[model samples]
Structure formats: structure tokens, C-alpha cells
Target chain A: MDVFFQQLVNGLTVGSLYALIALGYTMVYGILKIINFAHGDILMIGTFIGLVLVMNFHLAFVPALLLAMFITALMGILVERLAYRPVRAADKLIALLSALGVSIFLVNFAQLVWGTETHPFPVNISGEPIILGEVHIGTLQIWALGVSLLLMVGLHFFVNHTKMGVAMRATSFNVDYARLMGINVDNIISITFAIGSALAAAAGILIGVYYDAVYPVMGYSAGLKAFTAAVLGGIGSIPGAMLGGLLLGVLENEGAAYLSSGYKDAIAFALLIIILLIKPTGLMGRREQQKV
Target chain B: MLELKNVMVNYGVIPALKSISFKVEEGEIVTLIGANGAGKSTILKAICGLIKLKGGAITYQGDTISGMGAHLIIRRGISQVPEGRGIFANLTVEENLGLGAYVRKDKAEINRNLKVVYDRFPRLFERRKQVGGTLSGGEQQMLAIGRALMAAPKLLLLDEPSMGLAPLVVKEIFKIIKEINQTGTTILLVEQNARMALSVANRGYVMETGQIISHGTARELRDNEDVKKAYLGH
Candidate 1:
């Protein structure tokens, strides 16, 4: 097996997961023009919810994942309602601060309830690795890549084709005009949070399934990496987030295989800095057009 | 159909609209003509529920709509073609029109209204698939008016539709506005171009320094020396 190809596959599997979380960041940022700092903690909460559903209740993986995603979506809405909504009209900085508060509250709350100990993830499916001429691919890799792609495609169709999705885009374009068009902007915002959180939840559970370990602090590091991916793709663009995540994942894995495993996290941020330095708007971010 | 009774609005400490009162009886084109900073746009915003009135009441068909949410106000058959055209630059022309009918759930009715809008502006029909931003200024203004029309509003509020448009295009837009009024949709038009506005309007109000300085028929405003000097630019 080619070492480079093998590492690339490994990187893509992880990157797809990152893309999922990055989507949440990009989406909320698109609507509110603020980074949802609490999105990371939402990932942690989703993992724990998944863990309890599968481990304690003995439910199947798919059901648990869906349930966790639904619950995490509600948690997302709750965070927006409690922390972000009241401060929405005050100052942009206040909303950012409230997001940080929500992030901290979720992390400590998770520690208080689920504790700091890591729980081994309960996905017990097994399959032989798919071998090509030079690379070995596992079922988890396929699952991670396939599920994320499916969700992303579904999201794309929903945002582009559906009425509510069009309303979301309209609201993001101009809040006042959206209100003039009879769009309830507050509901649109809540729906944005809900969708973003659900995607993050799915990513969180996938990370746990891939690593076979679920822990409270996983979100902190993973979220930072995903956030880097979001910025890499240009913050508010959806496809940019996905592309950024995949690219970051591949780069991180290649760097780990060639340079050192200890440099994996550093590689992600390093790539982010390099990308931002070159393109400032991330990969897919639109350059502001000044019409004469 | 719509009336603003002593409506006052402020942008922080600076008063934008000063206890201004105006009326638009059903099926009439009532133009509010003023220079920039004369609160012409502010009155439109207040009527559409985009801004809270600092004081006074706005009644639509005899019900006080002053404190209603902007989103809810549209559902009651009031829609606005705001200043700047307010097109969703990223959305296609068809999508922009679809959003105009958002408050209504009846799909068949929406498509019928879509046909009416398209027929009224064949230029929009030709470019329906293109994103709204790429359209010429006049086309965007048409899309803005077309979008408001899709709401099937009883009272339509137009804010500076002629801003940034060619003279020929302005003539065409005002023609459509006249036709829309003939079809029984009441119009409250705010315009900086006083000559064109008063020419098309049945009744006209001249505003200055956040107050209506003169009010009369189009011919009355046309004959008034002060109106011609300040706004008609003769």
C-alpha cells in the first residue's frame, strides 16, 4: 500500500467530519455575522447524548444519532434564545460575548454531568477493509464520507430549492427587507441555529464512531480545527466550509504522516493562517463588489 | 385606505418624521414629494412597520396598525417597494418574486400573481433566471415593484422608484404605477422628482424639514411657486 494514499484516505475521513462542524459555524455566521462559539460545545453535548442513547438505552446507532441530532438542534435553539437573541440588536460584540458564555456554560455543564472521563464509543459494526492497488480503506471511512456527503447534499437542496431556505438566504441578505417581505426574521434565525446544531451533532457522533471514544473535551480541539476549516473556506460560504474541512483534513493527515503526529493540530491552524494570508476571504468567500 | 395621524419618528435624538399626518384614500395615487432628508422615506418605513413611531397612530382601513410587526403588516395587504430597490442580489429574479408572495400560502394564487407581474414587466420574464443584482438599475426597480406586486397588496408603498434610473425608464415605471392604480391598488408614492410625481398623482403633499408644507391636487402643487422652486426645479 502507498503510504501517501493511505494517509490521504485517513485524512479525508476526518476532514469530512470537520466539514460537518464547519458548516454550523459558516451558517450561523452567514445569518448573524457572528461566530457561534457555543457550536463546539453543542458537538460535545451531542456526543454525550449519543453515548447515553446507545450505551445506556441500548438503541441502534442510526436511531441514537438521529435522536441526538434532534435534541442538539433544540439545544442550539435554546442557546440562541437564551444567550444570543436578547443581545441581537444591542451590539455585535455583545452577541459574541454571549456565545462565549454559552460555550463555557455548556462545557462546564458537560463536565458536571458526564464528567471528564472518556467513554469508549459503542458502534460495534465490523467490516473488512477495502483494498485497492495501493491503499486500505475501512468501513468507518466510507460511513463518515458517505453520511456527511448525503447530509451536505440534502442541506444544499433544502437551502437552494425550498421556500424556507430561500427565506433564510433573503434574511441573511438584508434583515429589514426580509421583514418587509413578511418574513419573520427571528424564526429564520432560530431555524438557522437548529439546522447548524443538527449538522454539528451528526459530526460529533461520527467523530466518536470513527475514534471509538467519546469524551467531553473532544469538542474544544475538534471545534477549533473545524473553525479553522470554516475560516479557511471563507466564513459565511457553505461550500467553502465543506471544501475547507476536507482540505484541512487531508493536509493534517499528510503532515502527520510526513512530519510528525504531534504536529497534526498545528498543521490545521498553520494551513488556516497560510490560506487566510493569501485569500483573506477563505476559499469561497465572495469579494465585495462595489457597483457604480 | 391608509392614514398616518400625527406620526413622529426619530433616528436617536434627531427627529426624522415630526408628527406628520397624511391620508391615502382607496384607489388613489397620493404622492409625497420632498427633497432628500425631508422624511419622505421615513414615513414609508413607519407605514410598513419597519420603524416604531415615536408618537401618533397609523390606521389602515380604519384599524390602527402603528404597533404591528412589519412582517404581520404585509399579511394585511400592505407591501412596500423600499428605497434602494432592496433586491436580494444573490437570489434569482423568480426567487425574489417568490419571496414577495411569502406571507400567502396559496400556491395557485402566487403563480397567477407571478404571471401578472411577468406580463407587466416582460424584461423580468426574459431575465427571470438571472440573479437580481446583475440586472440594470431600472430592471432592479421593476423587480422591486414586481416583488411588491406579488404580495397582491391593496395598498402599495413605493419609495423613490426613479432613483438612479434613466429618464426613459422612469417614464416606463410611472406608466406601470398608473396602470397598477387604475386596477384599484391604492398607492402611497414618495418621490424626490416632484415634477414626475405630481404629474402622475391625483393628490400630492409637499414636505420639507419633516413636515407637510403644502397639500393640494396635482395641478395645485404644479401651479404653486414655492413647490416649483423647491422641488419641481423649474
Candidate 2:
């Protein structure tokens, strides 16, 4: 029973990271309807930036995390302007390919600068575990879960109550109508990319702190897992991404604990496939009605 | 006032509108009535800068706005309630209405407009917190018009505002359009429902196969033999 509880805690912590990254995927998809393939590599770049902030600048954990997020957000805006904007009117497939190209370029660029070495992020958080009855939880894990929950709440309010957030939602529903309403769709899209990338960066930083390791390829698995979460919840739904992340994390953790550790990734993929087959619009997504 | 002089538009290789010309005097409700393929919506799109004009000029308030982008055109005091009642499905009714005045920065004026919109459509006021997608077809059309009004536009362009609406609801919508016009916003209405459109408009244009076949006073168009046999179901 204790083992199960411990694994559940671990799953929740990892799930928070997945949820953060998945938010970026879901948000960009919501507004643009194009999958930003480079999103994963953006997470990877975030991790490296966090590493640089800590190792070279000798910054404390929280400050380093903020700097990393800021940098990643700016990088996201640059990517939108340079890569996404030019191909805005192109075919979806072309945009997809362009995102993939940007992803590959970022990965290689990180390799060149960081030298492909697996660098360790300094452990600033105390390694002590707090005992809660029979279950022991790492303090860092608790921090990760708390921050993730806070970020999600912040995002929810931001989208619901704010002026720019309303515009973003409007643009997503119909670009032509949004433009007619005098919403600067280009600026709104750029803001979406910025916010999404910043969330991914936060996830990358938390994951690095928990794992104590960062690499150029760190974004690959994390990205794939978050994408799975986004699909599981509902691609364009904000709350759906959070729910999907936690569910994927718990499912994979329990599967590894009881079934096979080596097949944990396989479990996530299987769940995705099954969900797609059963409900193509996802658990929370509604099927759009077409007008003739 | 708005004028489209020999305006041409094409969709890839096919021509959607061929050298169309018309004028809407300030403070008048002018309508363009036609069948489904008569390029009624295309004219609205061209006016709003959604599609590029191949040739000719669109002059609005003495400025040639033919090549301006949609956002810039809206800033110039024109708003469109497009076909299909294209309200933001995920946003709440209030948020959707708030976005209508996105280009405007005056908070007091915005709030004033909001109160006016709510007073005009008490249904929207009752469902201010509801998501736009869940609204009934009539409510959605009302919300679309209310949103356009939020922009404080000098000119309002409505495309098929009566589509997918019950006749009773259609009557209510036309009533609102007339009220909006009386309050001093010039209107360009495009509709397949010729009778309702002509009833509200001061002048009307008859379009067929992307060309304007006739234009006159709304009463004259309504009484014309060809219009009576084809559109009015006489």
C-alpha cells in the first residue's frame, strides 16, 4: 500500500511537468489550429537556458527559473515571427513541416552550444523527504506540484477574465470574425506563443530540478508525453490539458510499478490510440457541427 | 457613405464578383438581395478587406479603402456581422461583446455601449455569462449584431442576418436593424430573404450571377415584375 502511495506521489509530480508543457501545445493549437512541432525542442532549449543561468550566472533556483522562462518566452515570439508568420497562409502540412524543421534546428543549435554533455542542475532544494504517515514525499516534488497547480489557476483566470485573453479565444473561434471585430490577430497569436512557451519553460525547469540532469535531447520524451496528455484531455481545452497530464502520469507510473517499467511509454501511447479510436474528439472535446 | 466602383474579385481561377458597382448614402439602410451564388457575401468580404480586389475602387468617407487589411478597415469605423453568426463559440457572452470594442480604448464609452446593447437585447443580458456557442440561433444572431455595434462603427455591414432563423425571430432581428439604423449608423444589408431586406432598406440592388442586374428604390424593386415572380414568390 505504501509502495502504491509513493508511486502515486511520484506520478503526480511528473504529471505536473507534463501538464505545463502540454498547455503550450493545447494553447497554440487552440488559436492557430496548427501543431507546433517545434514546441518540444522549445522545452529542451528552456532546460539548457535554466542550466546556463544556474551554472554560469550562479543564480539561485527561483531567479534562474524566472530568467529561463523570460528567455524562452522571447524565443517563442521570435520563432512565431520568423517561421510561423511567413507560412501563416500556407497549407497545414507546410506549417507542420516548417515547425519540424525549426525543432531540428533548435536541437542541433543546443548541441553545438552546450556540447551535447548531460549537465547537472545544482540541487538548491533540500533533499529531505517529509514523512506523512507511512508515505514519504520529497520536498522538491511537493514544490513542483504546488507551482504547477498555481500556474494552472493563473492561466485559467488569465483566459477567462482578461481582455487580451478574450481576444485570443475569439481569434481561435473564427479568424475572419476576429479581424472584423478589430482584434489584431497577429499580435494575439504572438502572445499565445509567448505564454505557451513560458509555461513549457517552467516545466523544463521543474523537471530538471527533480531529475537533476539536463540534456539537449531532454525535450523529446517530455514533449511526446505532454502531446499525449494534450490529446487525452482535449486539444483546445485548457482544463482538459491539466486533467490529461495528471491522468497520463498516474497511469504510466502505476503501469510501471505493477506491470513493466520498460513499457511505461508503450502504455501512454496505447491509451492515446484507444482514446482516439473510441472518441476522436477526445474526452472533453465536442464534435463541431458543419453548416452547409 | 460607401461606394464600390467597378470592383472585381476572383477566387483562384473563377470569378466570384465581376465589376460590381454600388453606393450607400450615409444614414440609409441599403441592401443587396440575391440568390446563394450571386456574390452577396463576397461584396461584404471585399468591403471588409477579407479578399483582395482585382480592379476598381472602394471609397469610404472619401478614402480609397480597396487594399486596406481587415483590421485597418474596421479601425476606419466599419464592422461586419458575417454570415453564419460567427460569434466566438468558447467565450462567454460578455467577453464576446467586450471584444467587439477591442480597437476602442475609452472605458466609459465601452461601458455605455455595453449598457445599450444589453438594453437592446435583454436575452443577451440574461445570458451574459453563458458561452456563445450554446446560444440559440436567434440569440447568436442578436449577439453578432450587438458585437458589431460595440465597435461604434459608422457603417454596419450585415450578411445573411436572417439565415437559419425562425420567421418570428427574423422579424425581431429586422426590427433591431431598423433601430440600429435610426440611431445613426449607416447599414449595408445582404440577404437571400428579399422581402424582409427590402422592407427595411431605403434602396435595394438585385444581383444575379455576380452582376448587379437592377437597382432602384426599395419599393420599386419590390414591385418589379421580374423580382415579384422570382424572389417575392408572387
Instruction: Judging by lDDT against the true structure, name the best candidate.
Output: 1
Error of 2 at A227 (Å): 0.4
For model 2, the stretches where C-alpha displacement exceeds 4 angstroms are A126-128, A290-292
**What TM-score, computed on C-alpha atoms, does each candidate reach?**
0.97, 0.97
How far is A267's C-alpha from truth in model 2 (Å)?
Answer: 1.2
Write down the TM-score for model 2.
0.97
lDDT by residue for model 2 (A1-292), tens: 8879988998999998899999999889988898888998998898888888888899988888888999999999999999999998989898999998999999999989988988887757754778988887888898899888988999989987888888887887778889898888889998999999999998998998888888888888999999999999989878888989999999999899999899899999999999999887777765666332
| lDDT tens digits by residue: candidate 1, A1-292 | 3989999999999999999999999989888999998898899999899989998999888899899999999999999999999898788999989988988888889889988898889687666779998797998888888889999999999999999999999988888999999999899999999999999999999999888888878888889999999999989888999999999999999999999999998888888788878988988987656232
Error of 1 at A272 (Å): 2.1
* Model 2, span B55-82: residue lDDT tens: 8899999999999888999999999999
lDDT of 1 by residue, B1-234 (tens): 888999999999999988899889998999999889999999999998899899999999989999998998999999999889899998999999999999999989999999999998999999999999899898899999999999999999999999988899999999999999999899999999888898899999989989988899999999999988887677
Model 1 lDDT vs. the true structure?
0.91
lDDT of 1 at A159: 93
Model 2, docking class: medium
Off by over 4 Å in 1: A126-128, A288-292
